[model samples]
Target: MSHVANIMLSVDPDDRPTVESLSRWLQTSAPLRGHGPGATGRVGPLGGTTGEDTRRGDGGFPERDVYAGALDHADLDELIAHVERLAWRQPEFVHLFVTDQEQSSFRVWRFHGPKLRQISPEGREEEVRPAGGPPDIHTRFALAGDVELLRDMVVAAVNWGPGPAAPREAVLSDPRNAHYVDGWPRPGDLGLVALATREVDRWEPAPVGAAWLRHFTEDDPGYGFVGDDVPELSIGVDAAQRGRGTGTALIRRLLRTAREAGIERVSLSVGRDNPAVGLYTREGFRLHGRDEGEDSLTMVVHLR
Candidate 1:
């Protein structure tokens, strides 16, 4: 059975970029079927494969429309020839966005670092799997409200590299540990927990944990404080979830969130012992400074 992914877009009436346009924002250009002459760049309005309107918001200012379409199943070799083949692209995610809508834009979230299986409203499943994709799993997201949950994540992030178990009981007592979840859901604070419900009766969490950012003033800066304008990033997944490319998904989603929030960059501090440093490097974090006598490194990801 085919499962459909829905995409919503806000577009201006003129020269809007759509799936049909094949604008290739991050990926390069390729021949696409849905584009036509004299048609504004949007789904149905252009040509070829198009999206059906599930919901249409008022046409007044920032007109928004809900669109649902089938998952493209072009073979990976052919797909990669035209696009960069991002790690976050997956079988279950709807990667559609208003590629270049004039005067308006929406944040596009990547939900499929590990290709996920979807249960449609009609209960059908997406049958095609990408050639080298990860095992199919059901994905979930939630707010990091519970401090206990935040604490577990805190321990994970602090002890990221391969080594002895870092003390969890008194982890938060240290100023360094407190920096990550200290303000715990402060105003403008954002967090997203990753969960999977494939193997167990309930959602098993921490596979690729949450990515969080907190902005602090000079009066009280976190250990990784870059500036008042840049949010500091703290992320850690359970030991069970390491090395599966799940961390990449979490970081990209956090980057999307930061972009949506108008943040220019996000920063973090990590030690030399951490293996996960490569993950941040792959996601575009640059070394900004060193902490703790060269034992730790400070990094930042520019959103703008």
Candidate 2:
């Protein structure tokens, strides 16, 4: 009978000590980190571990090491491929290690994930798994008090990744669902409020005035502007309360107000690079234009 064994190993410059210790430990237990006859291993550039020969040096620093033995060649090959893919996706260079106890099967793999780049002194960027390419924005109206719930609803609208699916119907059916309608801030709804700031003098407050004051005490304190005429969609969510449809619910409620007001359009602005663009786009908002001075995109939705 053939024996099966599997292990996962990773090395990262970001995790210097851990990688070094793991490499040394694997070496001591078995001849997995160094070269020898009868022992199987592979080494190459971060992404080139899929071919037959494992020993093509690339003259690169932090080369990945894979040690394998005592397994059908096919299984070992698959393991190497999987590890290499994972490594290539990591932000920093990484090496993978695997070991099999029963038949003494072991292997190592390496790859470098997307690298981080600095776009400006204050801005840095990293590649994210594409979420359905560019996002599509939709607009909806919501009530003032239901802002929290609406945000959650919007988040539930899109499948962020392969986790448990969110409860779409339940999110939509809730009477509190806000962003489902158009022309937010119905005739008598409270105006959205802006947190008092030095910039307060820069823009005039809505003539109808703000009814309720809500401040997002997250990384940034965002003010909500609720009123009968002004658009009142919530932006950002509580760090702990995000990803459960709060943003969607908030937008839906605002849309409901808009529809009631007989308003056929609603709009908001977000920084071009804001992650919230994904959620806004999914909710039916679209980029109508851009504000170059502010580096913001003016997104709008038209209601029928």
Candidate 2 lDDT over 257-290, as tens digits, reads 4666576666665656667688778878877754
User: TM-score: which candidate is best?
Assistant: 1
Whole-model Cα lDDT per candidate?
A: 0.51, 0.38
The positional error of residue 239 in candidate 2, measured at the CA in angstroms, is 1.3
Indicate the residue-level lDDT of 105 in model 1: 28
Report the C-alpha lDDT of model 1 over 1-304, residue by residue, as the tens digit: 1121233422322323343343342123322222222222222221323234433365333333233332221122222232223322122333333211111222243233443222231212111221222343222233545556777888887776667867997787887678667657777687655543233422222234666777877888887787888788877776776676556666666677578778888888777667777878988998895455688788988887
lDDT: worst 10-residue window of model 2: 121-130
What is the Å distance of residue 11 in model 2 from its true position? 70
